[model samples]
Target: MGIKIGIIGAGGMAAYHIAGFRQAGAEVVALCDPNEAVARSAAAAHGVSRVFGDAESMFAALPELNAVSVIVPNKYHAPLTLQALAAGKHVFCEKPPALNALEMAEMKGLAERNKRTLMFNFNNRARPESVAMMDYVKNGEAGRINSAQAKWVRRTGIPGFGGWFTNKVLSGGGALVDLLHMIDLSMYLMGYPEPAWVLARTFDDFITDRTFKGPWGIPDAVNGVNDVETAAHGFVSFKTGQALSFQISWAEMVQREEVSAAFQGTKAGGMLRRLYGADGVDATATDLCEFYTQDHGRSSNRVVTVESDPDMGRVRSARNFVRSIEGTESPLNTPDQALILMKIIDGAYASARSGEPVKL
Candidate 1:
């Protein structure tokens, strides 16, 4: 029995959703995008038999669709998801579930009322490296995690000039939104610790003003009103006294692009990233048992070489979500977990707003 799936939003990410759904063995029945060309192109690409310019039209025309993968802008997530749930479709929405906590709660309530499964495309959690690390920590391979850090730092990069990403209303926040998975991965390795508070600061350089005087490629000085930050710093605390910090920049005065996460515990420590590695306190990999030893009245450091396979890390989350739909398992990226993340992010912004620490 093949599950019928419809896709909303025909953006760059819509393609990924189509691919993941196909990989999960769902039948691509319908496609919806505001742009007709985009919808047609996406339908052709995914072998979806139908296409529409709006989700309401798609839903009304294809009421038999069993599931929907929503990959729309942040502002429309709540209502779109609510309608899908009301129409009796299991929903897999893109991350940052809604614009805020209240919106999240509304959708959550709808899912409960409609008895639908609501999950996020938190592909970060589905990665094999992340799974391998979770197994290691839970098996006492990394000891008790006391501190962790995650970074999806990129050199100078920002999407869309005069676009939604740079506008707070459309994309929520800047680097935090982009680095959400970075933050998610850290807590995931620590067994999904309960976040207690967020202390954060956001920074926005006039990258757009200096580079593209107008909208990206639009070339109009009057259109330079994207007020979102280009970089951010966040310090978070968990219920177990575990601490997490992150540094991420989408566009800034920087030199390179690198992504990684670090876990520190009592016995062993581990780190993951693309470039530029920094070992943490009491953290040691299998081979780096001596890089940071107890040196009385002395200090030293050594480059640690850890082995990892990044490619194989992307299929687990898909399997988890698919199996849950197949009624053989439960969802890993549940609606509740997505709400937890949104709360943390909301707290981060609140902290930045009032220049004070926010208790979770």
Candidate 2:
């Protein structure tokens, strides 16, 4: 039989997971959420046969499920993943891995002990432009990236003032955690080096300002928590002598929304970026990928081009998870890598809190 899968959330992100698994030839047998009506609606829309009020009931009822896709709030990422893994199911979880390094480490340990495949949705790695850039990095073209800069900033892009996104306990942090794709992409291109220390700071200038709310249309809660930072800037020094600087923000004084990673390597340097005409609107975005090098002492700049991906490889990454389970494709990311990413994020927050650099 083909791979059978279940989804652990009935939120908007679950649609991407469902589409991806179905396209990858996996049978999406069930969807579960605390809101039964919402789960049932999503199931009907996606052609899933079963809907449950909780994961435990879904797992108990669907004994044939061999895998699960987790698309929930950041706080529940680790717990849901651990639950699914303990039930002998391979798991694909949404980004940021977990709220902090400790939780991520525990999830990694459980997945290892259970011997189940645990992959996070580091979707940018699977993008067409990113794939093209990697061809150069892996083939000795962009040799040993020595330094990199990752940015995902917006002038007016706080998701919501009083939503879960602004609740540090629920969403981990603000823009640093929510818009972490660029940081992960930069690290991926740099080979995910071991870090020695991090120096960083966070800003919450516009945290409570509804004027800076994003265009995603997520409503604000009337009386909800909004205690996370609005922006974060950090620098990391890796054990390999490489370094990275990052600027992430949900709201800031900027020209527009920009997502990018630029790197300097021993041989060549390159950049991958997406510029948005409006914050949080994919339709108004423009992507660019290019490399810088010298040929016979003459400056040579090569622009890499590919078909644009509006989903930013979300579906592709999920499909890759299915293929990896089938032994046809290698997973794009591992739990160990996620642990490393989380460590850096945790360190950045710690450094910001203490107003001093944090040592890894």
Q: What are the clashing pairs of model 2?
A: none
- Summarize candidate 1's per-residue lDDT along 4-60 as a digit string, tens digits: 888898776666666666777877789898888988998887688898999889889
Model 1, position 136, has a per-residue lDDT of 66
- List the candidate 2 regions with Cα displacement exceeding 4 Å: 279-284
Q: Each prediction's TM-score against the native?
A: 0.84, 0.98
Best candidate (score: lDDT): 2
* lDDT (Cα atoms) of all candidates against the true structure: 0.73, 0.92
**What count of clashes does model 2 give?**
0
Model 2's alpha-carbon lDDT is: 0.92
Q: Native-vs-model 1 lDDT?
A: 0.73
Q: Which residues of candidate 1, in runs, are more than 4 Å off?
A: 209-224, 276-319
